[model samples]
Structures are given as C-alpha cells and as structure tokens.
Target: MYLEKLAEGKTEIGESGLPPRPPENFDMTKFDRGRKFIQDHVICHVLAMFISLVCGMSVVNLLEPLIFTNNSDTPNKAYRRYISTFMHVTKWYYGNIWEENNKAQTSILTVRNMHNKVRKDMTAHEAKIKNSESVDIDSLNHERIASCPMAMKDVRLSQYDMSLVQTGFLGIVVMYPRFVGIDCTEAELDDFVYFWYGVGYMLGITDKNNICKEGFHITRDICKEIEQQILIPSLENPPSQFYPMAKAFIDGGNIAHKNKLNSVESVLAIGYHGMNVKLPKLSFMDYCRYLFLRGFVIVIYYCPPVKKLFNKIIRHFFWDSSVLEKKMN
Candidate 1:
C-alpha cells in the first residue's frame, strides 16, 4: 500500500503535482543549521554530488531523454548543463530558499519547466516506440529501452521517479557521510534532512510522497531501502548505456573543473568498489588517476587550509559570488 501511494505520483503530471506552498511551520533554525552543514563540508557535499550522479546512472533509461536527448549534444553543452545544475543546487543550499521569488524557488520552477518539456518529447517518442514494428527495432535501441524498469509503462516522469531522485541527493550524505569524509552530529543530520523536505515540497513532490517528508530517522531508513533495493541492484546490472552516460557526465564534470584530473570517476570508483559492485578492469593510467584522486580527497578533507582553499577555487570557478552574497544577505 505504501509503495502504491508513491507509484501513484507517476500519474500526477504537470503543475498539479506541486504543493500550493512550501512546507508549513518552517523551522528556520533547522534550515540554517542544514545550510551550515553544507557550508562547513562543502568539499564533502561536492564529492557526494558526484557519487550520487554516478549512482543515478542506474536509471539511465528512465532519464535518457532528460540526459542524452537534451542539451548534452556536445561536450561544451554538457558542461553548461552540469554547471547550471551545480549552481542551482548550491542556491538551494545557500540562499533564501523558501522566500518567494528567490534563487532556490526560481531554480526549482525552472527545473519543472525543463521536466515538462521532456515529458512532452518523451510522450511522442514513447508512442513511436510502441507503434513501431519489431523489424524496425535495432539491437541498440532495444537494449537501451528494455533496460528500463519503467519502460513502456509511461513515458512521462512520475512523482515516484522524482522521489528516487530526491534520494540520490539526500542518500549518501545522510546515510553514508563518511564516504565523502563527513563527520557530523545526528542533530545536524536531521536539520539537513529537514531542509531537503522543504525542497522536496517545492520540487512537486507531494507531502505524502516526499522522500524527506518523514523527518530524519524515517528518511534515513527509506534512503537505506532504496540504496539496498534499487540503487545497488541497478549498479550491479546496468545496461550498455550506463558506461557511456556515466562517462558523459564525468566528462562534463571535468569541464566544470577546467581540469581533467578532477574526474567524478574518483568518487564513483571509490564508492562502487566499497559497495562491492563489479566494475570492468581499468587501464593502468586510469588506476593512477584514481590513486591521485584518493590522495586529493584525503588532503582536502583533513586539512582545513586546503579545504578552505578548495572551496574558494570551486566558488570562483563555477559560481557567481555576487549571487551568493545577494541570496545570503
């Protein structure tokens, strides 16, 4: 019955799915603590974002149109798409998120608009796939679509899908913070989860179906179930598109960093191997890069000066300082 309620979100399309307002009785203290959590551990949160993205490749087929079929045609465009994502996510963490017409609110609406466009495009594509003759189905296309657990079910992105995505962001950081070198208190974690609950509401996830709606412990348990049941399983049995899509996303990350050495694969490799997920053998050079990244993560996390310096570099490279100042003020 619980799963059924979440699955129902698949049908709650368009603006109708969004809550009329943000979550009520907003705990500003908790929200501020959550913002501090991210601010204090910026490098860890950034690392967690990469880890989440790689894990998200598990739903590549469900996300194909949003990814492959969108602004990812060229390396430069892919870079822009991811950088925009980083900025939006940062705004959610740092800005006057719940305030009307703020960066966070506007960013969530922009994302919804983008989702609507994809929903329209996928509707036509889904129909084409359903009506096409078997003889017209090529091996590559068949494999890609067949890999989707939600294939032929509904071309539109569902609330259930958004719930899973919400997990991608909140999961690793809350459940396995140490994976990204985070060492925080339980109360702080709760505050962080509380912040995202409000974010979930603004992102069209109904209170009943919001991944983070249940507060800290329940949300953690839910994220644990998703990691054990869906995310890990998907990683263990990914389709042909998984590697390509993951590589494309990492390539964009490299672009954002303006240095290929800062590959998101560093996080992916460590996280997957830690989880006992089987991966193809990598070249010797790839292994060397992973080693370098491991060392980099360690130095940045344990060394405060290095961590501060790294944070400044990231802000300088990807964000507008003025926007942060304005939102924060």
Candidate 2:
C-alpha cells in the first residue's frame, strides 16, 4: 500500500522511490562542516583551551577587593601580601599542572589533603577561641589574615578570601563561558564545572559558600548579589589604608607589555581568544572580532591534523616531564 501511494504521487517521495531532495541552493558545506566537527577531536581542543585559560586568566583576579580596602587594616595588608605571593603560587600551579599524571610537588590530592587538614585545625582552633572568650580574634595568626573580609583568618589563610580565590577559577573558566566567553558546548562546560566543584569539595569549601555547584546563570546571579552586598565604607568603618598591593592590573599589564616584549600579552590573549571573550572595557570592535572568531574557531577544529598538532604542543608545554613529580607519594 505504501508503494502504491508513492506510485500515485501521494507521497513526498513521489515516483522516484527516494526521499524528496532539499532545495538546490541548500549549502552542502554546512553538513560537511558539521560532519567534520563530529569526526575531529573537538573536545580535546576545547579542553586544551580550558586548561590554558586556567593557567592564564587565574592571575587577573588576584587584586580584587582592592577597590574596597586600605593598607592598614588586615584585609588590605593581607590581600596585597597575597597577590605579592602569587608568583610563588604560579610556580606551585605549574608544578601541579605540568607533571603529566605523576605525583608532583603540588598534585591535586596533595594540596587537597593539606586543605582538609588545615580546615580541621581551624575548626578546633575556632572552638578554642570561642571557649576562651579572652583572646582577640584580630590577634590570631599573628594578625596576618585577621577577622573580616568575609573570611576569618584560620590556621594559615583567610577562609573567606581563600574561598573567593578558589571560586574565582571556577567562575572565569565555567560561568563566563556560558554567555560572555568561549564557545564551549553545554557538556564541555558542565564537565569542567563539575571537575572544579570536586576540587572545591576536596579543598574544604563549605556547603554554605561553595558557589561553583550551581549552574552558570545562578552562579552569575550570585556574583551580582555579592557585588551589591559588599559593605561599602562608612565613616564608622573606613577602608583600611594601605599601599596598593600590586599595581592596578591595567598599569601592570601595560608595563609588562612594554618591558616583556608582550609575553604577557600573548598569555592574556589566550584567554581573550580561547574564550571568545573580550573584557567589557574593550571597544565594540573587539566584541565584533570576538563574535567573528567564535565562528572561526570551528574552522580551527576542522583543519587537517590540527587537533593532533595542538595536542602535541599542549603536552610539550604543560604535560611533559617535571621535577615536581619526584615528590609524589
């Protein structure tokens, strides 16, 4: 009966015994590109960019809260000191990241264990402080981290400040990509988000404060709430006066561009391009370029043998032999 209907021109296939054709002008190149994308190791390149963003953009937020604090107060002094130590942190990051799958100077498990231990110590210490009711909280940790800044100074670090630093990585890498940044598919973004949330758990982020578990939109909304709820300086509660921690990022970025022959620019550009995101401070032209590149990056995945070549470069730079691996248990 189906064949008879088709023979009588009662079916879309007509008498040809085949499905109807698409319009002649329908570009086969679209389908070809789509097929090529599926065949190519697109996920590998997306992940490479993800790691690259981690290494590169993580520095950008090192000086936040500077706008709200001064040098004398603990928050001001503490955070500036934190940024000053960022170079050392980068060394630890490189070690943790580049040593292939081997145990390294700063493996995830190693730092995670340390973070957990520190959290345990802080809880006990807090109980002691509360019970004593005699010691000033400001005097804890030798007045380094001090109370306030949304984080208390614990055994070693400020819990609130460290929480911010920890979540900053997840925010830039996962949340921004959902709208303003690169073209990560939902699956790739979710996997990356989930991985960091695991790290957050390992690092002792409390259920109350861990922001990375929420999906991207909710996380961003949380960010806006934080910005609003930041306690602005009142006459009674002035910002702690202090020297600037690092130079303003723009000043430092420009100076580095000048002195370093744009090694700084090159790294920053990876975040800029890899995410298809330009800072809002940049011009409309830059956003247009980002939009153009969002589409263009698809071509990158489809290039002949490029995924293999890109993966080789990524391994050479970030996954090769490392001295740090010697310390692994």
Candidate 3:
C-alpha cells in the first residue's frame, strides 16, 4: 500500500495517513540551500557549541532507565554511549540542519529508525533475561561492562520518558527563536517542531505529547511537568550507578571540557526552571570558565569577519560550505 501511494506521485504524508497538499509558491530550490552561504557559515559554531556543551550532555538526565538499581556503576558505559551519540548527531545535524527540502528530511527518519531498532532489541534482551530459567550474574556483568549497559540491562526506557523527549525538542523550538540575533521565524519553528513530532511518534510517544497544537506554552508545560515530576526527583536522589557515566562524560578526554560546561549548565538550567538537581559539583572558578566559554562562543559565531574567514577556509580546502550543506541533505 505504501509503495502504491508513492506510484501516484504523493510526496506528503501526515500523521493521519492522508497526503497534505504542498503550500503554493514554496520554493524548493532555496530551501534546498539550507542557509545562504553566509548564514550557514555563521551559525555553525553556535549550533555545534550548543550541542556539545549543553544540550548534548543534558540528555543523560533523560535516560530515566539509569535509575534502575540493577544497572548501577556503569558511567563508563553511559559515557561511551552518549559520547558516540553526541558525535553522530552533531555531525549529522550541522551537516544538513539548514535545509527545508525533502532530500534532507530522510536523515532524521534514518536516525529515528535506528533508535527504534535499538529500543526493540533492548526490550527483547531484557525480556529474555527476565524470563530466563536461571540467572548468570557474572556473564551478565561482563556483557554489561563491555557494552555500557546502564540503560539496557533489565528494562527499556519508559514510554512517559520517551514522551518527555518530544517535549524537550519542542522546548528548543520555543527557546531558539528568542536568541538575540537569530531570526527563527514562526514557519521555521513550525518546521522544526513538525520534524521532531515525527521523531516523537517513532520513539513511541502518543498524540497527547504532541502539543504542537497547543503552541509552545502548553508544550513547555509538558516539559515543566516532566522536570517537576520525573527529572527533579531522580536527580536530587540520583542513583549511585549513574554517577560514573556522568563522570565519564565530564572527564572523557575528547569532550571533558564540554562535559564540564554541560554539568554546570545543567545546574543553572534546572535552577532557572525553579527546580534543582544535585549535579556533579564544580568550584566557583570552574563555573566562571564554562560561562565564559558559552558567551565567547556566541560572540564568535555572530562575528561577520570570523564567518567570512571561515567560509574562505572551508572553500579553500574542503568544498564550499553551502555546497557541502546541500549535499549533506
């Protein structure tokens, strides 16, 4: 049936399984460019730094399955998992982030399908372990240690937690527009949210979590509820097992500095929401350093001279940044 519909020239499929007509005069060519050469050039650093230092690291909190006792003391595993994820997402995201055309849309779908496969495999593994005729603790421990089993041991991520991740993306859509210089228009925001809403569905969330209808306000309310109800309680009394994973993220050689920045930012972000999480402690001076890096990143990304120079650099050795961006899509 799906293949047959494609034979009929249907390009748009909505959640309701109906095809929506394309908007009139929507220029497919310009959307394919992602950002003009200069725009993609300027925002690269902003997007990268945001993912590396803040949003990337905070995803650990969303790994609610780590709260389970059977999966204690596996920060090394979590570190391995999240760091790999960070690298994949950063490269994939910035590589194709600016395009509004269909060609690049499959990237998210591919990632989502990968996520679904992993979830199904893990859930099956957990079920096998639980229904086993006997237990093998040592063997299980070895596998868990070797493979980073914090979130995979005897359970899967809860449906509610998965739902919360949808809200998290919506939060980004809401807040990104408020960036001082970036003109994230309503149409842009809607595209961003719509993309993630598909992601949410693939991740096993329900329509109730799809607050794109209620606007950012209600979307944020769901985010707040996730924090107050699940996030805060888990963090304040965080499981001992998850700390090593957090440590690996914070101390991992490749991304330690960014991890430290993430840790501190997590503290501030949580507090800003009138909530608290007992994040890994850092000294006052450490706090200053991360804050400074965050601010400095924004400054450099917005500086036109820097952007122009970087654009030249990319065109010099690599392909044109704009060409690469579109090609990635």
Candidate 4:
C-alpha cells in the first residue's frame, strides 16, 4: 500500500520537457565563495594548534611559583606540592587521555596494598615460631638467612622496599631544579613529583623490607632476637640521627607483618594478582612536544624583549596581512 502511493505521483517526462530548475534566487556562487574563504584562511587552523600548545605550556610554567612558596604554611607542603603538580601536569599533558593513566594508578595501589598484607602475615608467623620452639635460630650465625623459609619470604617482601629506593632515586634525578627548570608553575612541579611517586608506587618501589638487606632477611627468630637486643635498647634512648627513616622502616615492617606468604605458590599468587591491571603509556613524542611548548612559553614570559619581538612578528605576519589595503597617504 505504501509503494502504491509513491508510484501514483510518478510521471513519465518526454526528453523535450524543460528540466526542473532550482529556485530562481538560489546562487551557487555563495557556496563557492564560502569554500574559497575557508581555503584562503587555512593558516588559521595551523595557528589555532600553535596557540593551544602555547597556552598549555604557559599553564605549566605558571604553576610552580604559585603553589610552593616559602610562605605556604601547609604541613608536608613539599609532599603535597608533588601530588598536586603531578595531577595538573598529567591532566594538561594527557587531558582527554587520562583513562589509562588512572587505571595504572589503581593497579599500583592494589599491589602496594597486597604487599603490605603479605608482610604482616609473615611477621606473625615468625613470632609464633620463635615463641613456641625457642630454636635460637640467631645463634646459627649466617650472614644471609637463605635456609629459613620464613626468612626467605621476608627477603622476598623486601623487594618492595628496594623498589621504593629505586623510585626515590629516580625522582631525585628527574625532578631536580636544573632538570625540570625553575620557570615551571607550582602545579607543573607538583605534577612532576606526583608522576614519579605514582610510578614508584605502581612499580612496587615503596616496599620497606626491600630497602635494607638486614631488614629483608628478618625471620621469626631474628626478629625476636632483634627486639630483645637492638629494639629494646633503642626504646630507652632513640638515636637522634636516622630517626625518621628508622621510624618509617618500623612502620613499614608492622604493615608487612599482616601480609605473609607461606609457600612459593603464595608468593607467585601475590605477584600475579595485579597482573591484569592496566596503565596509560603516553607517547614520549607528545610529552617532549609539551615540554618544548612549555619552555617556549616560559621564555616568552621571563624575557620581555622576546615577548615584544613575538608580538611584532605576529602583527606583521597576520594582522597586517589580513588588512584589505594599506592606508592612503
């Protein structure tokens, strides 16, 4: 029925009949003129891209001084600055490309959390073994506790601490004042700090046991011996130097006690658990481009002469060129 209605309006036309004409006032020239206008201003598209790049860098350059000033009264201001700077830099650099980076961050946190758990469990098992048997494992006198299974687990958990040391070293190297530059904004600087810390956390670099060899080989027997000999003495009068780092180590050890891995399979299980986690891998080329543009903005901002020169050049090239004609004498 629908097809029949459509067919009813159809008419057979003779070749001699005048073809249907477009509206009398319709001007094809208008469409052509519009196309020509766009073709003539192709440089505008390129200029827009340049402007965006410059703006993004400018934001980064402006962030550091604004956030990390000497008067900034926030506690742990340096740490906070690192976190904030990382987020801002990442957002600016990646913007719409943040999903993968976020996923990677989640995975790293998961691994860290699990690593903490295994350490705790191991600590408890070591305590029970030492208290029940009184085997006096410390008297055996081996520099490395390779034979003790609990000690081996402790050693393995120590890998996380080693990871943290590696990350901290890398952070110090990459985030140096000379390396990232003084012109970067507080936000950008914070971003730089956060990026490395986040990467370290994800890579299992912040684990405590792995940082020191003696700490790594801690077993049920060894810990008991240490508590009686070293820790008790320290409690009476803690060393002034290395106190903070030592405290951090003790705290990390406590966390590890809850996360013991008894068997080889358990060890493998913890390692493999976060394997499915994903991370964003931003292109190095894009990051380099971002840095270059940021540097360019900083140069313009810091040097008034360069800014004036840029303005003059832009005026001559674009504004002057866009004028229909020169002023008459």
Candidate 5:
C-alpha cells in the first residue's frame, strides 16, 4: 500500500488543490522547533546529502528518462548541476519558509518552474521525432531507445518520482540517524520530518503523495521500505550509468569544496559505513580511513563542542554562498 500509493505520485503535478500548510495542522508548536532542528545540524545534513546522492544515482526509474538528460549525464557537468540544485535545497532549509517572500518559498517555486520547463523540453523533443517522416519508431532498436532520454517523449514528471526524491533528503536521516549523526529526541525528529513536509508541499507534491504526510514514524517506515526494495538492490547491481553519475557527484563535490579526499577508497568507505552494505574489499589504509571517518562522525555527534566547531566550518564552506541566488539574480 505504501509503495503503490507513492508510485501513483508519478502522474501527479501542481498543488493538487491544497493550500500550503506548515506544521499548524499537525502540531503548531513544532513549526519553529522544526526550523531550528535543521539549523542546528549542518554536518549531519551534509552527510545526508552524500547518502541522498548515492541513493538517487542507483534508482533507474529516476535516472533513465529524466535524470539521464544532458544536464547530469556527463561527469564534467553533473557535479556543477547537482551542487546548484542542492544549494537551492540549502536555501529552503535556512530561510524562513512560512514568510511570504522568503527564500524558502521562492526557491521551491523556482524548482517547480524548472521542473515544468524540463517537461516542456522533453515533450517538444519527442514531438519533433514523431513528426519526422524519416524516423520509424517501430523499427528502432528497443535497447537504444531505452537508453535515451528521448524515449520519455510524452511522459510527465510524476508525483511519485518527486516524493522519492524527497526521501533522498529525509530517509537517510530518519532511518540511519547514527550514520549521519542525527542526535535528537523523537519530537525533534518529528519536527524535522514536518519541516520537510512543508517543503514538499511547497514543491507541488500533492498532499496525498507527500512522503512526510503521515508524520514521522510512518514516513520513516516508508523510507526504509524504499531503501530495502529499491535503493539497496540498485546499488548492489547498479546500471552502467550509476558509476559515471556517482563518480561525478563525488568528484564535483570534492572539487567545489576543495576536499582532498575523494578517492574510490573514500567513496567505498562511505558506502559501507552509511548504508551498512558490504562492498568490494578495501586496502589496509582505506579501511583505516573508513574507521577514522566513522569515529569522527561519532565524535561530532556526541561531543557538543566538536559538533559546534564542525557546524561552523560546514556553514562557512558549503552554505555561505547560494548558487540559486546567483542564478535568480
């Protein structure tokens, strides 16, 4: 029931006739608390971004037709594209979402506009092909068509896919809090879920298809199921595109941040630790680095002073500039 309902979201777009509601409908007090929860956990949030990217690349449903488009298909450009994308996400988390003219509201609306544009572009591409007398769809190689984004000629970006993308942000934190260093009360976690719920609503996710619609516990379960059924399987037997996309994501992030450690070993270390999955064997030094990162993450979570220091560095390095701001201006 959970997965099916979510799958139905692929056909849904727009506001679904629902007003934008923050936390008031569920728990009025959680609104501000929800905002603060995100504000206070910068490092964990960054880790969640890494996990989200890994999960996203693995999901073929999202990649082949939509994500596999020119924007992210190539390594050289994928990182810049994603960095710009997540910078907008960071704006929504940092800005006051409930305020009418706030960055959060503006950013979400902007993303909706971008999505609509992609749909139009894809549809137009398909139309041209269909009208071409030289082309014969029936005679085309099925594999070739399947590998191309042009195959999505008449398809619309469904609500189902958007919600899955939402899970990329929320699921890892909820399901593997320790991996991401999410140290908080049940109430705080609930607040965090509601926080994303509001963001999802503003992003034009229909109320019925909202991943956080059912609140924290149920939504966490839904995220877990996705990880088990879809995400994990895809990772285990990833398609050809996953390597280039995932490598590009890691490489781009490292280069943008001036991070020195983006080796295959580093990526493998994170995959093993964050997702609790067995991967190819690592060298002695690689294993040591993994242990160091794992231990460092634990220290950041348990030691308030250390966590505070890291959060400051994270904000300065990753959040100081907004890519969306540059684009909008």
Candidate 6:
C-alpha cells in the first residue's frame, strides 16, 4: 500500500524508497521527539560527570597535606615551614588578584612616585647641610648633645633601635610614598636599597653575623638579633643586579665591593623580591579554603598526639561540622 501510494505520488518516497508518512493518527514526530530526549539525557549525564570530577578533585586537594610530611631535620623546621607556607599563600593571593583585575597597575606607579619624593627631600636636606657654616654646625652638634639628656645613663642603642632607624629611613625613601604622599628619585631609591642590604646583614644572614652564641643554641631571640645586626648590614651596598639603583654608585676601583654587592643584590633581587613579585590574587573564599587546607595539613603532619586530639575536637565542632552536616542532612 505504501509502494502504491508512492507510485501514485500521493506520498513522498524517502531515500530508503518507502512512504514518508506514518499511519493516520500515528505520532509522526516520535523520531524527532526521541532524538531530543536522548540529546537532553546525554547533556545531563555529561554535566553530572563533570560535576562529580570536580567534587572528587576538591576532596583530594583537601586531603593532600595528610599524605605528605617534611622529613628534613633542620633546626626550627616548624618556623621555616610556616614561613614557606606563608610565602606560598601570599604569592597565590597576589597572582589571583592581578588575574581578576588585569588593569590594576597601582603598585609600580606608587613605588615610582614614592622614589621621586624621597629623592627630592634628600636633595633639599643635602643643600641645607652644605650651606651651614662652621658656627652653625657647632651649634647644631651642641643642640644634638643637649637633646641626648640620657647620654650618661645605661642607654646604649639596642640592635632593634638601629634596625628600626635603618628600616624607617629606607621606608621614608622607598615605601612611604606608595602608602603616603612621598616621592623618591633614582638616587633615593638607590640609597633605600643600600640601606636595606645593610639591614639584611645586621639580621645575621651574612658572614659577619654568622657566629654562634656562647650558651644557648639558636633561640628565636638570638636568630632575631642576628637578623637585625648581621644579616641586614651584610645585605647593604648590594650589587647592581640586586638593586639596579646601586649601579649608579659603582666606580672602577671598587671591583671587589661591586662584586660583593652584586652577589648580595642578586640574592635579594633575584631571590627574595622575585618571589614577592610573583604573589597571586585569591578570592576570600579561596583563601579561606587554602587556609583550611593548610591548617588541616599542619595538624596531621606536625601536631603532637594530644594536640591533635584537641585539634580534632575543634575541627569537628568548628571547621568540618557544617560540611558533614550538609552531607548528611
């Protein structure tokens, strides 16, 4: 009947040479309907799979710290670990911030402006000093001595005091303008770097401050003192690479000094600041997640059993409780 219908031209023949029409009252749209149904089902299945993968990965990421521990026997490993972790977290946060707001070009401009302002102030101060006569200098020195009323007391400047002064001066030149209204010129910027390097040596990381204390072995106070006194000063007058601003001060006869400065500069510039510059931006939620993950890891990896038990209770009540509740009910 379908062939006859096709031959009589009452119904159109499909490519398969059968009548295109279904029986009267039949649902002719079933094939289209079935295809639509399958497509929707497949899409839903794919979406479910993707969601499952993401959820699984999140769980794995959360649990990763439990699976690894540092095996190094270095003194103050915990402190080192904390510093390393903080650096990592900071970098992640910094990068993410920039990624989210690509046009946020504030840091560089702020730093440059700060440099310019400090330079201008320094120039003015130098001019004032140069114009002062011998009488004026004597009078100024007398005033300075008079101001130090406690000179006869037990008032030797602490390492901290010196560090504060150095850092403060550098901050005025390099950092103040970024946060405040100061501007630094190229010379001031160089001076800032030189001061910081000196400060770094005083902090005890450099050769000059590497001596061990007499009795106590490497206490936090001792380390801090070393850092403030030794490491900071050693870092001062760094090479051009460490502080590009230092290049302006180098003379031909000061090859050894230049080399030492370069070495220190390379370490600080290429190492410390380099790491600082690469910090990532992170959303608050993401940061919280990272902190939670880190805390979880530290608890598992480093905490004593008793502390771990306490932490577990805290974790259950404070951190993980909501997550578990949501999963269950």
Best by TM-score: 5
Q: Worst ten-residue run, lDDT, model 5?
A: 137-146
lDDT of 1 at 77: 70
Worst 10 contiguous positions by lDDT, candidate 4: 9-18
Please identify which of the two predictions, 4 or 6, would achieve the higher lDDT against the true structure: 4
Ranking by TM-score: 5, 1, 3, 2, 4, 6
lDDT of 6: 0.28
lDDT of 2 by residue, 1-329 (tens): 21121122211110111112222353334433322322233334344333332232222222222322333134334334333333233333333322355333345445545444554555565566567766675353413323224233323333343444554454444444422224457655555444444344435454334555554455555533432232111111322321222223323433534642212233334344444445334445544544554444454545545545654553343336433223221
**Residue 33 displacement (Å), model 3:** 13
Candidate 1 regions with alpha-carbon error over 4 angstroms: 1-5, 14-16, 128-150, 255-259, 262-267, 274-280, 316-329
Off by over 4 Å in 3: 1-61, 64-106, 137-159, 170-191, 198-206, 211-213, 253-281, 297-329
User: lDDT by residue for model 1 over 1-329, one digit each (tens)?
Assistant: 34556667777653345453655687778778887788777777888777787767766534565443546534667666666777778777766766788877777777777877777766776676778887566545555555555556663666777788788787888887765777778888998898888777777766766877777888888877777777777876775666666667778767766877645455566667545566546667667777776677678767778878877766664454665344432
Return the TM-score for candidate 2, rounded to 2 decimals: 0.40
| Candidate 6: residue 231 Cα off by (Å) | 2.1
Query: Can you write out model 6's per-residue Cα lDDT over 214-268, one digit (the tens) per residue?
Result: 1112222343343344334334422222222122222111352343222212223
Using lDDT as the yardstick, the better of models 1 and 2 is 1
Model 4 ranges with Cα > 4 A deviation: 1-106, 134-170, 174-187, 196-329
Separately for all candidates shown, the number of backbone clashes (residues 3 or more apart, or on different chains) is 0, 8, 4, 36, 4, 57
lDDT measured at residue 240 in model 5 versus the true structure, 0 to 100: 66
TM-score to native of every candidate shown: 0.83, 0.40, 0.55, 0.22, 0.84, 0.18
Candidate 3's TM-score reads 0.55
What is the per-residue lDDT of model 3 for residues 77-125, given as tens digits with 9 covering 90 to 100? 4454444443333333334433344323344445555545555555666
- Give model 2 RMSD, 1 decimal: 18.6
